[model samples]
Target chain A: MKNNTKIRKSHGSGGQQSHDLLENVFIPHFRNSYLSDLEDSAVLEGWNGNIAFTTDSYVVDPLQFPGGDIGKLAVSGTINDLAVRGAKPLYLTAGFILEEGLEISVLDNIVRSMAETSKQSGVKIVAGDTKVVSRGSADKLFINTAGIGSVPENLKLGAKYIEPGDEIIINGNIGDHGLAVLLAREDFGLITDIESDVNPLSSLIRKVLDADVKLHAMRDPTRGGLASTLNEIAQLRSVDMYIDEDHIPISDTVESVCQLLGLDPFSIANEGKALFFVAPDDCGRLLQILGSQPLGVHAARIGTVRAGNGQVVLNTRIGGNRLIDMPLGELLPRIC
Target chain B: MKAEIQKIVDEIHTECGEEPIRLMEVCGTHTMAIHRYGLRSMLPSNLQLVSGPGCPVCVTPIHFIDAVLQLATRDDTVICTFGDLIRVPGSSASLESEKMNGHQVRVVYSPVDALRMAIRDKHLHYIFIGVGFETTAPAVAAVIEMARENKVTNFSVACAHKTMPEALKRLAADRQIQIQGLICPGHVSAIIGIQAYEWLAKHHNIACVVSGFDPGDILVSVLMLCRQIKRNECVAGIQYDRVVKAIGNTKALALMHRVFEPCDSEWRGLGMIPASGLAIKSGFRRFDALYRFPVKVKKSPTPSGCICGDILKGIKTPLQCGLFAKECRPDSPIGACMVSSEGTCAAFFKYQVVKSCA
Candidate 1:
């Protein structure tokens, strides 16, 4: 392994030398299950049914952005991962890698934000871990979270079950998360009030699952956004996909930011949105179920699976068609 | 919009006779747009589309990559670069691969990140890999201005910056290349203005159209260029009128002029072109790495039989390269053209160019 010592020192005070800024911020806010108070592990009660587990690391620079912070990001990111996997998140285990010399107050604020987000997400922080390095070792803060949730019975969802003729649906707009972070960095001087839609999708997924909707596959559009997610789905099912660009939901603010940055919103990242591969007959019901939720107001039936050799084609609003390929490399790096 | 675009394509198909006319889009975004829109399928075999050296990262020489690798290898040096340049392979390896070998390579969204790195590391030297056209050069120049104002001595930029008009002129002048028309970059045009392209039309007698990244914009630009070729007229046309203006962004241009002065810069394929690269003005020379480090590194030659130079000039296609696909894939790129997503070879490889034989 490379020497972590030199890397640790560069993270100065303004840099916030905390590895898990989320834990440092949230532990004090939620006194009920402040895992920081405990020494080793968080004690939790066993669940009765099938459980879902997911882990994610957040390293978005300018830790705090338009809509959320690293604390909220860590919670929402992990929650969304399990939520799309058809799980009702019950607990989250947060691990923080703090760089030395991080301000105690910023850590408090991050923890506080995490507590509020956990409350909003309806999940408790039951267990957590923390490690400190000399400043330069990590970014101001890096959050790693593992979450567990109870899976409902008779709910079978995965790419393997996806079949031809299924409709692909996106919960809302894409690229808000990526654009929000980009704007927050103030790198380009282009400014907008667009905040990251970094909220947990568990509640929305729960609504859909409760409606008894049949989902062949469900994935959160995170790092690589909608393009990569759909490409993965198409490749996994050995089927082709046809999406209409006009039908896809995109905020005007998001579109403007993308234009300014010379970035494609389809390829940008999103934390609050999920793409679902549902049976054609079940799409209407799923849309209705999704529409009932606050996060699913912009839900859309963007595309359908076709008979082909696993290609993803996007039909533009102007009647031209283009292939949406998987993102080759890092577009927005360290984004959850 | 689809009907209009299709109608234009049909008209071009009918106008161009049995002999095909080759049109090269010199913008990276245009290449990506053509590939993404599957525009290749819509165009008649009579019209051929090729990608040019509009991609700054793609045209950046291997020596620059090696220089960056050298900088990254230094414990006190933090090499900051745009996201696209990270994966571009040099002679030995790419910065991404070098990062795996314990190099301090960080993919930054903006030059400000490099400035921030410099501020964070007081003792270490922070060198921002300054790369791109006029669209990006202004922001980098601004960062340099900011560093100078703040008296941040640790910060310096390794400028591999290039200008578009000169490169286009050089390509058109090369007798080996037969570029009939040019699809200029919308982003770069928006910064430098359409007025800058008059040289291409005036000197090279080539049809130039500033096009947008959108599929509709590209289709319209192609139609415009075909009309110019048919009318035997050479002029700069604007298809991306939504954002790009004839005069361009004056404020951005002023900012660029304030900090950077035009210099003879070397391109990976086209060699040294006059007034092609941007160097920090004498007043801002403190932020330049060349002035600070004073290293006399020998310029390395392109990989043998790479043919990237010829391909960049639009004289040959990626298929002409012996290593293309067989030995030089995106994962193991042997040339700068294959390494960058915007490079002609990379575009051809990514889109799987369908060669047409007479």
Candidate 2:
């Protein structure tokens, strides 16, 4: 099995020296049972249970931005996806596609970030793979992660169960991640203090799921933002959502940046936030539970689900209403 | 808030009844706000609010688009533009369609992106399609400053920018279009100041109200314009008092004057308005694309059966076009006015104005 692991790591390495380092250092450092003999796979033997599986890719431009890097991005993205499904993340498998001639120091920093983030999220990085392509073939580095979690027996979470009159709540302000990336890119030469809230949410989610409140469905507003995610829920449940624009939590810096760029914060991407659809009776308790945690410090109830034919509308601050249509195309392409 | 706006609308209707008053909002932002907020539905049927050629993309001439397209097709040239200008159709094709044909065209959020690209790619020549009004013109001018300071000779700009007050004067002078008042743009007013439109108000007897992009702002501006028209008063009124000041941003205007000088510019519909466009001054002419490339473009005629010219002049609507929504959908635009989201035709098409009117 050790020899097989070597072969698999070499094959996944695609001729990069980092694969050799991972196999030599990281693999040998971990216990033998955690080491998988298969390529990009981890084997475990324990009590049987239903497993929650989720995968995500990080392709944020510049590879680095204010407050986080792609390594932190990969871990948080997958963990959040698993947490919203009412699962407790146990392990994560990371796959790296490194561009040829990339700096070894940059790769080392990214790997270190992944390790730190895994520790913070209380998950073990049991298996990983690396591949290198020709220079310019890949944009710096791309990280793909697959996570496995154990779902609690009593937890029932899905869009199908979302009922009318349910309350919609968000963990924190939207557009922080998008604005941080934009400010770091300096694409418009504007300066702001907004930073990406790219953090692991497994601990926070575990706390929320452990509470007595009933959560019908939970999703992190990532790529297409709060508006697009709400639209997805609306369509899935065949219901309508009415969100108050003024009630949505947006920082002053984010608001100013969006105003200047002609962007809607609701449509901007967010990384370290979750949207919870809870029973109307449980909203106050859920808010109390979330507010107790650091991750959900800015949590607020933004809207409610109404009986309609699957559409999302916003009651704007100006006392007028506008449809929050599905995003036509990538609002900010290459943003994780 | 709804009742307050409704009351203002009622006052406007009472004042403008039985009069065929055509009020035009000469700002792309205003055009978007009107459609996005459904403000057209609140106005009286007889009081027509037409969209003017305030959209820089809609008014940019075909020769400018052709020149950018030509540059984009080059082996070592890349064209950078704002998102709105990519799909605007020129005489033959748009920059977006040209890009699909293997040309290098990038959509940038700002002019600084073009400057950054020029600095990053030493081999490729970068030509920024400078197409906007005063609000954007200053930013492009700032890019020129950065390029010069960094000694980045690979970057040049194809300036197709126009001024607002000059176009407003042209629209007012034209007897064919009966425009009673104007809703001026808040952003442009923030740069050029409210004093820029003094001539238009004094001679044309047109009330100009600088308005914001909110529903309440538009409603209040409309009421102000109606009040002025009813009393035979002509002046520049400002409703967006928060962001727009009387003198405007002097620092931005100073940077603009340092890099560019006013020249006679050709509009797509309104042709050859004097001192309407900005050109790189003699000292800054090294960054001018026209001087560097020296390409002679054969003036192509506007597409037949397309009334974009009249539509932009506020003399016609998108419904007047035979191919407004049938052929000029947002995905497949046939003219500049339908290509940009802020364009009159695009704002109408996106909001399904035709169906709403029916």
Candidate 3:
């Protein structure tokens, strides 16, 4: 294997430099039999029953962050998307657009993270692509992952299956991923060791399937955070959402950071958490089961579905009610 | 605390009785908290909660945004601004749109971040869009001080800061709204002091209660306002006793006074009011964008029929505007009030989800 320590513009020239990167960097880490074919696409046996397909692009700044790098985020985000739909992620394809002058060591670490995350999540990186542009053309690095997963025929889930009386539950706290990443940027000069909650949720989700707690709907709140996720669910189901403020789990650190920055924790992003809608009867048992797991320890029943037009409301801890609307514009640093 | 809040809420509901008690919350953050707590839905129908000129982003005049846009278009300048300012439309263009069209606009977390950027990169001029109410002016003033101490020659600030008490006084005197009381801002009150609102109460004969951000604090303040009105008494009080003081933060006020002085500033809704906006003092004129960058902010025509000014003055609600929920939205906010996340129009559009059934 050749030791290329840096990615030059020629690395994406589709010439000897590109070949060197593929052989030395990509192949050894993701040397599946099908991937080794070096064909245009990897040929694989399709799932027996149903399949789930998802594509996500990761463009988080400061390629490497506290808990994970862009590579880990890319892989985990795809798998989480698949897992929330009751699908077992089987194969993922990674595409990297690296900026010129990025050290190969950084790429190597990211690649290693992606490989390890894929293996741990029971998925294979069967195919991948890499491109390097001028330093000004892109940020340090951006990764896009497309995953193909197998959905068991017995598993049927969507907003249509969600009922008005169904209970909404979150795996853990909100705003960790966003706040972690924000602090990692060090733009605000705030120093905190809050790691990004960027982990694949396939295992914990599979546990729910095994428990058979009658989960109706699930979503991994990513970009717009939990507010957008619940809003999507509410709009899709055409039902009102009542989220209890006291029940929603938020760490003291995340809460304080949000308060200082005037950001709503509910509106901030979460990468590793899953929001589940289940029947009220099974919600308690499901919460207990989720609480038993590590990721779900802070798991809680946050809200209830009501029969009305699509609306998301937060029942404040002070016994008042307020609308939890979609995030608008941007979360500016506010003093008041 | 919960029971006490409930007790107050119950009493306010009973006392406010059929006549439709109109109270205006005069802070952007209060508007957000009111919506976040779903307080509007929980309040009695007879009690109408109106928004005032408290949202700095909503109340910012069109010319201020236009001035910032001109500075952004300059190749020699790196425009630093808060998140909401980037999206706010200025006549034909916005900072966000300008950025997309290849202008250099950096969305910063705070004025301190802008100061840092100016210090780090001396190759380009940095102009921070200092836009906010008194609650934020002190921080911007601090940045100006930092810029001076560091001798950051290329750093300057475009001031569009508003004063809260003056706006509230004008809001109270407006005959169209008929607002019975004012739920004053907690943070602004902390800086300007709870005593700052005494003039508003004394002169306008309106009940003013500086309240905290919590739902309970707001509910209790509303109840206090109801009690004041019930007794036909006009007085000022502070519900946020822990954070706010009678005389305000003297140190911050001193810094603000040292860096800036009151100037007749134009507001998007309220028009030109005396001593209602901050302008960098002549001694610090070199750090002021209006003085350093002489850009003629041509009186660009305001968005036709945009009721942002009316909404900010509490003369009209977002729903009263014809474009609301149809043409005016947070994503493509046609009115200044719809631009900020805390803007009354954006709040109404987003929270009014359950309004149809309610």
Candidate 4:
């Protein structure tokens, strides 16, 4: 009703147009035997276990960015949430709020991205609903993903398992995803080729779980980067965290941007990375194992946990110590 | 380079003889760099590095913030400010809290963004809370020129701009702080030139060394200061020669001079100092928020449990403050020095992260 492929209000009116969009676009892209039924609720044919259910919304301003898009982000974010809880991701339900007058090509690209990501991650988009709001009432598009994953009876990972002498490990470099997104915004005249490190980390987590190393606590540093994640772990586990500035791996490009912008690389968010709290002896083995993989080539043991209430300290390269405080206000709004 | 710095520090430690050397770093970045690199641990027990009132946010009086918060509440006004200023507390509330209360306060990375925002919303009064030293002033002045050229009537600046030379001069005159040498500001030197420290060097007989915001640069500058003091040579030295010139950025000076003139200004800890603050000149008076808005700033009151005044004046360290770490923290800062990233208390809390009593 709008352009050749532009979206309109009627498309979300729960009429013939909505049916046509589902049958033509959503159905063909995310087609599976279970998804083809087009029922109100998705019935996973034979799924029963301790299911880990989580939901996250994506509304990044520049919907498309280098290394990933809003679609990929929506999938990756929810997938990582499940993966961190020691679960093998199973199915995802995507709900979209489309702004009227959006180009069908843009929606097409987002949908295609979602479908590709889902297929690659071995998850089926079993159900979805779309709603179109009037122009100015909504941004270009907003995607909400609700995912459910299954956890084995023996597989248990959380703060309760963490000990004082455990080691803090990261998959890759810090501050890449947040910095890449910022550079992609093209604000402040900063230009960098840094791409968003947004990826579904389920495969790598599974590989690590398959290994002999004991992962006490596992989490993805999504919103607040390494600092926030460590702070949360410390608060939950009733311990102190001390990381050496020299040990924390940071790229030269990311460091330069942080220097220019007065932003801390540790405090910046990471989309594709995960933090693992492992025993001191197992830290070396875990690092070697994670480093061998493509998703975690730069894995390193960054810090050590100590017996304290709740504090994260950074042992400075110059030989002093500083507290890594939880960022109070929004470091970068709409970052996730 | 690290070993060479260690050697220099050793030589300076030996050169100190009996009395300890108290050198003050006047820039906030230098304070941060020293802590970030853990330079304090590397320094000799005889040499003590202190913080001066160089941080613009740390030294900005409470009334200025109260005035800005008042302006933010107005229906027809929009407040444009740098990110850090939003968190700095006034008497009752801050711009960050006001924003959460549905005020139109925008955090801009650069002053140009605020100017552009002002031009875009012509119907609304846009007040940019200008807070910085000479390094940022020239850039803000350049954008003011653009605003004037385009005749952006809505744009005005609540200027809290200050100069480093006057503040440094006042510190040299103060006796209690015990400053034997000086580590000058790198970014401010890039604007006002290395020659700006000549007066303090000649009159006060203090060895002033300009430094870049890096561990090596700061160490090299400290070593230079130590050697100068050892040799009894009170002069201005430039160690950050790559970015800062001997004479300084002349074109930037011209732009700054064209937009602002010297006036008596009130520093947070230091009382009213003459010719320290900059006011928009008559040519650019139209962009002055002081003239446009009837700013009723309350009588500035010292923060209840903060000794940031003495901390900025080099008389007291963050550890010396009663409320530090216990009550005054980054999340709920009791003073301006704890709010800004580069402030002395913030640098101490962030890098030291230790209980003073312990």
Which numbered prediction scores highest in TM-score against the true structure? 3
- Clash count for candidate 4 is 2
Candidate achieving higher TM-score, 1 or 3: 3
lDDT, candidate 1, B33-106, per-residue tens: 78756687677777888777888987887777777777777777778888678878766667888789887887
Candidate 3 collision pairs: A321-B37, A321-B38, A322-B37, A322-B38, B269-B309
What DockQ, on C-alphas, does every prediction get?
A: 0.15, 0.15, 0.51, 0.40
Ranking by DockQ: 3, 4, 1, 2
Tens-digit lDDT string for candidate 3 (B211-270): 998888888899889888888787888899999989999999999999999988888877
List, residue by residue over B54-162, the lDDT tens digit for candidate 2. 8898888888888887878888888888888887777788887999999899988878888888999899889998999999999999999899999999999998888
Which wins on DockQ, candidate 1 or candidate 4? Answer: 4
Error of 3 at B113 (Å): 3.9
lDDT of 3 by residue, A144-213 (tens): 8999998888777987899999999999988888887778765677887677888999999999988999
Top candidate on DockQ is: 3
| Per-candidate clashes, comma-separated | 22, 0, 5, 2
Model 4 chain A poorest ten-residue lDDT run: A314-323
Question: What is candidate 4's TM-score against the reference?
Answer: 0.89
Candidate 4 structure quality by residue, lDDT tens digits, B112-166: 8888887777889888889999989998899889999998999889899999888
Name the regions of candidate 4 deviating beyond 4 angstroms: A3-15, A45-49, A100-104, A131-138, A280-284, A306-310, B1-19, B66-80, B90-128, B143-156, B194-196, B229-233, B292-296, B319-334, B354-358
Task: Report the Cα lDDT for residue B57, model 3.
Answer: 86
Off by over 4 Å in 3: A1-3, A13-16, A37-41, A45-47, A328-336, B142-152, B194-196, B353-358
Docking class of 2: incorrect
Q: Judged by lDDT relative to the true structure, which candidate is superior, 1 or 2? A: 2
Task: Please tell me the interface RMSD, in Å, for model 2.
Answer: 4.3
Question: Compared with the true structure, what per-residue lDDT tens digits does model 4 show for residues A1-336?
Answer: 447488889889999988888887788888887779867898775556688899999998788887889999999999999998988898999999999989878988888999998888898888899999999989999999999998887776888898989999998888988888787875777767788899999999888898958889898998888878888988987889988887898899999999888888878988899989999988888998898899999998888989998888777665555678776556776766
